[model samples]
Target: MLRFEGKVALVTAGAQGIGEAVARRIAAEGGSVVVTDLQEDRIKALAAELGDALAVRLDVTVRDEVDAAVAAAVERFGRLDVLVNNAGGCIVSTVPEDTSDSEWHRQLDLTLVGAARCIQASLPHLVQTRGNVVTISSVNGLAAFGNLEYAAAKAGQIAMTQNFAARYGGMGVRFNVVAPGTINTPNWDNQPDTLEKFKALYPLGRVGRPEDIAAAVAFLASDDASWITGHTLPVEGGVLTGPGLLDLTPTGPFRKDY
Candidate 1:
């Protein structure tokens, strides 16, 4: 189970939720973690709790912060073995009809471009260590869910991951994407009933948990998936099956009908 015995990983948005789960999982597997999040106190506490971890205050949307986080990872851990792009979330407020260009840019900037920045900063260190990247995308990227701009950016993440895999595979590095379905995280705290309602849409009879995603990410980032790259693994609870009337469209529950 110590798949990351001698490895090191940098996880963005590692304060809580899925990012926290990923950090905990990697640490549990004996990996050194560079836990970066906007919440300084939270990440610092998490780093202390993980024993062999470093906490960094990183705003993925900021290039300087991203670069500094990568540099800090190499400085502390001596090398960077994995980069987990887990900083993105749905931030759009306007409906598709009135969504502004600025909002679109903001969404793409955070979700898509932010990940690219981390990859760019980590590539050199990863090249030396033959490491890899695992981006946390969403099922909306692969299907017709809602969150128009978010979905588009997530889809762009997948496209970029594939391209990077192709471009870097020969250099002893790999790239992959993990598209998750509805997971019970703090992001759903505002709408407690939403997860309950969405559970029926899944064939597994329950929504996903952060641990579910952590398991998938651990596999993809570990040596177990050394031959796997340019791949998008959906960690949904069978929601993608679309059983019966469970159609995820603009009018579906998956959509934020703002």
Candidate 2:
């Protein structure tokens, strides 16, 4: 259970949802976690709950803030073992035509550039520790599931992960991504019915929980995945494989018996 013992992990957007779950998982498994987010109060509360965690206010879009947060983590933990690029979301306008130039820039900046900023800032420390990176991408990035801007940024994360993995492989720094499906989080708080509708899209007959993605992240960041690099593990309850076509036709596709 203590796979991350003596390790220090920094998780961005760790105030809630998937980021919070990842922080909690790492801490629970004996890792020193630095929970970073724009929500100072929630992050501090989470750090308190984790007991050994350090809470840092970080807005990934800001380069200075990202650098400062990484510096603080190293200052507190002595070295950084894992960096989780978890802060990102889609804008309200999912339509490509409806998305303005500013909206496209905003989504790319927050979701893609933001992660790159954190990685650049953490690379020096990661190299020192020969650590790894676990980036939080989405199934939308791998497929056209809507949210065009956000999906573009998520896809960029995968490319970035591969590049980093190749560039830093000699240094013993691995890079990987977790592309999650329809996870039941506060992002769906206002769309409960929509979430219910999405359940049928997944072959598992249910949407994912935060812990589901967190488990994949933990494995990628742990030594158990030491030989793995430049890989993207889809943690989407069979959604990435294919939609549940049979669920749409319960009559068994016009079987003779029927």
Candidate 3:
């Protein structure tokens, strides 16, 4: 459980949702965490709650801020053992036809390029510690789901992971990704019924939680997954395997209590 007892991790957008979950999980496992987000108050509050955590204001889209945040993490922790690129989301445009050029660029810059910047900034320390990177991508990147621009950016993260793994694996740094499906986060506050709608799609009979993704991320970042790199772990409750066909059957496949 204390896989990161002596490690230090830097997480982006760690104020809420999956990012916060990841920071909490890492810290729970004894890692010193640097939590960063645009919301300074929330991140500072989270840092206070996390005891050994440090809060840094970061806007991933800004190169200067990204560099400064990385420097601050090293200055505070001496070394960065993990970098969780969790600061990303889709814009209002859900479909390719409706997505404007600016929207496309913005999505790619924030979700894809922002991650690249952090990786670049943290690689030196990761290489020094022989650490790893766990990027939070989405299932939309692997399948033809909605949110075209966001999906494209997420897919880019996967490609970057593979390339970085190949390029840096020999140097002791690893790169991997976790693709989550229909997570029930604050983003769905406007659609209270969304969880019910997504439940029928997953074989597990429910959508995902932030903790679900956090668990996978912790595993990938831990030494337990030291040999695993350039891989995409789909912590999607079997939604990517296929639809919940058995749920539609009259007897529920085995007819057990159906």
Candidate 4:
């Protein structure tokens, strides 16, 4: 049951949502987890709940904070076995005509650059331990979405996965991406329309839960996925397979429009 027994894991943005779920899963699987997040109170509380975890305040975009967090992980756990770069999230943007330079840059910073910083901070430790990295990318990266900056950032993240895999696979380190589709996180609560749209588009008729992405993360971080690297695994419930009918047209009572 303890697939990651005796491993040392550092998860970025481990305070809530998919990141939190991944951290809990790692702990449950017998790994010593360092839950790093910018939200001190949330991570502190989470660390308390997950008795085997250590909480650290880390702003992945900040180099000093990134270094300190990594150092803390190594200091507390002796060695780092895995680095889960699960920190990035949606950075809202506007249409091409309205999009500002700062907004675009901010999206790239939060989604792509943040992941890059985490990887940079953890690379040496990962190389030392011959560990693995599981980055939480998005299906939006693989396909076109209206959110230009967010999609571009995610695509950059996926590219980074491949580059890292090629660069470090010989060093006994592995890198991979888990691209989830329309995950129902706290952000979904703020935008009810997104949830409805995702369910409409998804063949499974429901949006993804945090654990769905967490499960993929756990597998990728474990030795069980030893042969997998540089791969973008779509944990998207077949969203990439084909388009689902938004409305089947008069086939059901709920079918009101075309």
Candidate 5:
């Protein structure tokens, strides 16, 4: 249970959703956590909720903010052992033609480049403690998502993880990625059809829970995964195994769509 005992972790966008879940998991497993978010109020609230963890206001897209967040973590915890780059999201619709250049940049900033920036800011401290990095990318990173910009950005994060793992393994800083599929988060509140649609493709017959991804992240951050690096683990409930791109074919009476 105390897999992360004595470890200090920083989870970006940790105020809510997947990020929040990750922070809580780390704390539960005996790690001291620093929860960072752009929403100062929520960050403070979550920090209070996490008891011993620190709450930091950070906009991952801003280099200074990223640096400050990492500094705060190291300052409070005395050392940094894990960095969870979980703050990125699709800020706009994936309709490529309609997505403006700014939107594209924003998507990449929040999802891909944001992780890179956080990594850069934390690398020094990570190297000092032989820490690990767990980036929350998307299954779209490997497959095609019409949300071309988001997909591209997530893909970039995966590439960054692989390269960082290769370069930093020597420094005792390992890097790995966890790609979740159709997670049931606040973001999905806007998509009424997402659950029904996702269940059809997800072999597990349900949308993923934040805790599911969090468990995988904690393992990768723990010594159990010390030998694992440059790996992209899809916590997708078997969705990645088959042609999940298309919905299941309806049978007999269920063929209403047909």
Candidate 6:
């Protein structure tokens, strides 16, 4: 389905992993994509590979860069129909109490404030086109996922999206979030065994894939979700349903084969 035909989308952190997956999905669905990231080489290669895509070296943490990226999108595509805020990540590694103010500032600046910057820069064009914004949040934002700073920043994204949705609903510009669980992204490359261990913790018996998130973001960004605004769609693998005990496993009590 070409849900994004004749439309344009700007995705932050579109170098690889979830961001790259989202960009590919949008392009596959017939949208012109603006792929922005600090990885100049990767983004450039990806944009070239995608044909109708633009590569913008955007550091979402910087306001000037964010504004410039948005402007570039409009200039290149003639309009911006969607803004995918995919730049944020878990940066603070310190424990909650041990986390320094500087660390907290950096975390929030990158995740929370960064998304706001993109939205602020894209708002005018979105308003003109009656467009939408899809933010990639995390399940950590909804529950106690251990990383305090990261969780807080993710939660802030949810709150910010809700407010934006409410404020801009009348203008026909929607705002929503895709809160995903442990996706097998490059972030887990260092800990090869970690994703394996994480699978047992999920009720679905497997960890998430970047394509899983791309699908959710696509749904929320498309006109298919026209009435969906200010909502956080948890695309987790049913991990949020309850404690994912071993009972759900094939050999466990909850399993049955026909």
Among these predicted structures, which one has the highest lDDT? 1
Query: What overall lDDT goes with each candidate model?
Result: 0.92, 0.89, 0.89, 0.84, 0.86, 0.90
lDDT of 2 by residue, 25-144 (tens): 999999999999999999999999998899999999999999999999999889999999999987546456777888899999999999999999999999999999999999878976
What would the TM-scores of all predictions be? 0.97, 0.93, 0.93, 0.92, 0.92, 0.94
Candidate 4 deviation (Cα RMSD): 4.5
Candidates sorted on lDDT, descending:
1, 6, 2, 3, 5, 4
Q: What tens-digit string does per-residue lDDT give for candidate 5 at 1-258?
A: 999889899999888889989999999999899999988898898888878899999988899999998988888889999999998877675446788888988888788888999999999999999999999998878875445677789899999999999999998999999999878887768765756666776778887999999999999999999999999999988877855655434331112211
Runs in model 4 with CA error above 4 Å? 245-258
Over the stretch 160-249, how does candidate 4's per-residue lDDT look in tens digits? Answer: 999999999999999999998777777667777646755766778888999999999999999899999999999987767746533323
CA shift at 15, candidate 1, in angstroms?
Answer: 0.5
Per-residue CA lDDT of candidate 1, range 1-258, in tens? 899999999999999999999999999999999999999999999999999999999999999999999999888889999999999988897778999989999999999999999999999999999999999999989988788899999999999999999999999999999999888888788887887888778888888999999999999999999999999999988778858225656777767531
Candidate number achieving the greatest TM-score relative to the actual structure: 1
Q: How many Å off is the CA of 159 in candidate 4? A: 0.6
Q: For model 3, state the Cα shift of residue 21 in Å.
A: 0.7
Error of 2 at 3 (Å): 1.1
Error of 3 at 48 (Å): 0.5
Error of 1 at 124 (Å): 0.4
The TM-score, computed over Cα atoms with residue i paired to residue i, of candidate 1 is 0.97
- For candidate 6, give the lDDT: 0.90
RMSD of model 1 against the true structure: 1.2
What is candidate 3's CA lDDT for residue 142?
89
User: How far does residue 222 in candidate 2 sit from its true spot (Å)?
Assistant: 0.2
Name model 5 segments beyond 4 Å from true: 247-258
